[model samples]
Target: MSTQQPENTAPADRKVILVTGASSGIGAAIAARLVTEGHLVVAGARRTDRLRELATSTTEEAARSGGALEPVRLDVTDRADVAAFVQGARDRHGRVDVLINNAGVMPLSRLDSLLVDEWDRMIDVNVRGLLHGIAAALPVFTAQGSGHLVTVASIGAHEVVPTAAVYCGTKYAAWAITEGLRQEVDPSIRVTTISPGVVDSELAHTITEAGAAEAMRSYRAHAMGPDAIAAAVSYALAQPADIDVNEIVVRPARQR
Candidate 1:
């Protein structure tokens, strides 16, 4: 077991990673996984209680690995909040090694359903939220000369399904935004998009449409656990600094 270091200093192998939407599901799994790998994980979300629970649950692992989990209240839709989130981490740790833009909402409904609010919610969280993260972290990475940006996009980014038109559009934007960042940034800054297929998560609980909700229930019957996607994130981060893994799509074998 390793003893914890001072707040301002991190070991050479330890990374300062910030994760958004970390209250539950994929975000929580990613934060826990990174912390166990000896990285300092700043987990942010709207649900402070769940965030605290996550920190409590990982206390022993973090202590043993010389990692630490810091839970902060965050609303990704607010640009200022996100900027402050990144700035706070840099202020505390001296540098932020990675930013995982994982906050997203999915309220599947047909175009004719006229669920404009749901559509807007998806755009705000999925599209604008990703942009907000990039906006906040790009400068930090540029100033530091190195950083990794990981987007937890959905497989919907690649293909559309019934009632997922708006959701898929937002995801496609996430994929495109991340791809554009990868092309524009210097090689010192790494970018990756993780597209997951039907992972067990709370995203579907947002679907108010009865039909879409019912359909998702059947579709998710063969879903993979959140840890599966966490493993993908770890794999991307584990690569050498010189190797930039552009994108990875992880789906359950049973998914068609």
Candidate 2:
């Protein structure tokens, strides 16, 4: 009821933000940037070894920035893993102020190719994984009375391209699902979706089709760096609480 300036106490006063797929690429960049901004960052990934390495780097960065980073092993596709990771993050940090669901797979192939296996993988890791993130964080958000959901999608979600039907579908689903979640959640919870176009990352490495992978590699050669997207995310988070920055599309200047 009071518009109060909560004291920025110890590291705990900073928002406990959790970022998925933080071992590398955009997620990692975001985690580091938030840490640099003096927020407590929880970095989660499927690779525990990579998590360990990132934890070490985060610790050094935290020492330099006067913040803290907690790293955890998480597989978003596994519901149990998601639950456990969310619980562990809350237990370690005492609260979750933000969740960036950035884990996804992009295995592009022509629909004629069927690529059922690839399709399933994309849906599981991209759509269902995001759902898992919401399931894990929503309760905490409700109890805390303030939180944020930041999701990573792609420009393909709004447009269509060859040999990327399924991938686009999943991203589109993410786009819609996040919007729906935003519409349904109480005003206290902020939901933001970031759709990036051709930012440099290893997403193309997961493509199974030779032609598709090569084409994507060519586009990636000219793509924006992950730091660009990180900046956009930071901007969204740094905004005033009442101004729920809903959606942002970060693409290279030449990506059009």
Candidate 3:
């Protein structure tokens, strides 16, 4: 029997990373930074148009950085769509080295406001969406014997605040679920949860509750940019495979 050498020999300098919720804010920032750092970024979001725009802008950056970004339409709450999203990335890139479950929503409301619809939306997107990403990528990671799962949670995961009870519950669930997966997965499969404090993003735009909206205006007065969270993600992804960064919490200096 003749021994055959491995066929693919592309330089091993870059990773194939899949990012959800890449239309704007932290997800978009992470996608941009990863591509600029020489990783192939497969970005997905409900806003296909924004994804396309991001791809277009990144193309010029790719020429200088040796990385590229590809866009896909993804709604992480849809199981089938999320599966297809991961499979499509694998089909195009040969493997998924990382999956960033970064899509989330925050529609803050006090208990009395009774914004039941907004509460359900948070659970569906923040909790279920995260689970979908894990379900879609965990099998791939197991088969490959190496992969990373990054979850973009919030400081809300750490504490409950007025007008944010429901939102905080979902983020707390995210943190717990991510940690649970980390414990259950193989040693080579890494899991990271990022909890960010108030950041300038469209998350606040979704707030409709009057009291909550007014409170957010003050709370967000000194918010950090999404790029700050992106930098934390880069730090996590850049670590050696042997060193898994379990959790990262980033907040603005002035924020209490």
Instruction: Write the residue-wise lDDT of candidate 1 on 131-224 in tens digits.
Output: 9999999999999999999999999999999999999999999999999999999999999999999999999999999999999999999999
Candidate 3 on 181-203: residue-level lDDT in tens?
A: 99999989999999999999999
Task: Estimate, for each residue in 73-104, the C-alpha lDDT of model 2 and write its tens digit.
Answer: 88999999998888888887688899999998
Segments in model 3 whose C-alpha atoms lie over 4 Å from true places: 1-11
Instruction: Please give the lDDT score for candidate 2.
Output: 0.87
For each candidate in the order shown, give its overall lDDT on alpha carbons.
Answer: 0.95, 0.87, 0.93
Candidate number achieving the greatest TM-score relative to the actual structure: 1
Candidate order (lDDT): 1, 3, 2
Per-candidate RMSD vs. true structure? 2.8, 5.9, 6.2
TM-score of each: 0.96, 0.93, 0.95
Model 2 vs. true fold: TM: 0.93
